[model samples]
Target: MKKIIITLSIALSFALPSYAFADQAACEAKAVSKDGKPLYGAAKDASIKKCMGDAKPNDCEAKAVSKDGKPLYGAAKTASIKKCEGGK
Candidate 1:
């Protein structure tokens, strides 16, 4: 039982970091502009940062609303969330 527990713990330790790295790579691959161009400098940094789960979770999503209190949709919501996440 002790050997099984130790083996399982070791497996989980390796699995967790690889999973995080895979997510990070996916985020980096997605760091591009709307025009299909790759982002550079601060933009790329911000994209990766947000994608790697550095953003304020649902705070920005909840704030995505129009002045008239209507929920923002599509590009507007995306832009709003990006801005709230400290991106350009």
Candidate 2:
């Protein structure tokens, strides 16, 4: 039991840092990558482009959909469509 406990503790030490350091709130704001993988922890809008292959933030749109792949603004890509979507 002593050896088992030590082994588990060592494993948790290695794994916990990566898991504990992530901020869940920031990750929710930005949608996942093109391949449908959630980006790590809630990052600023610009961070959406980083850690997911280092693309320029401005190069991509803020996704017409939410992180869960729901159409936020329908098929509309224009300001008018956005206004309707936002119920403005």
Candidate 3:
């Protein structure tokens, strides 16, 4: 029992910090990319949230004046909001 408890504690000690750091980093990256723009992250997964948000998923114009931008074209807009993963 003591050994189990110790092992669990040790595992949590390492896992918790890494998890926290990853989330923070994801948020930081999103903020940097936003660059005055706005975005949200997945409440559950920092990476998933970051990926979709970074993709800039919707309504973004390719040319604004005369071009059709696709999803992968990047830059989230109204239509792209759906691509936000969790829609944060």
Best by lDDT: 1
Candidate 1 stretches with Cα past 4 Å from truth are 55-88
Estimate every model's Cα lDDT from 0 to 1.
0.91, 0.53, 0.53
Regions more than 4 Å wrong, model 3: 33-88
Error of 1 at 23 (Å): 0.6
Q: Which stretches of candidate 2 lie over 4 Å from their true place?
A: 21-88
Give a tens-digit lDDT track for model 2, residues 25-83: 34444556677776555544446444333433333335544667765553554553444
CA-only RMSD, every prediction? 8.5, 15.1, 13.3
Decoy 1 TM-score against native: 0.59
Spell out the clash pairs found in candidate 1: none
How many residue pairs collide in each prediction? 0, 4, 4
Q: How far is 60's C-alpha from truth in model 3 (Å)? A: 39
The sequence of per-residue lDDT tens digits that candidate 1 reaches over residues 1-88 is 9999999999999999999999988998999999999999999989998788775749889999999999999999999999988884
**TM-score for all models, in order of appearance:** 0.59, 0.27, 0.36
**Candidate 3 on 5-88: residue-level lDDT in tens?**
999999999999898778777765655333554445543355455554544423333322223544332343433444343454
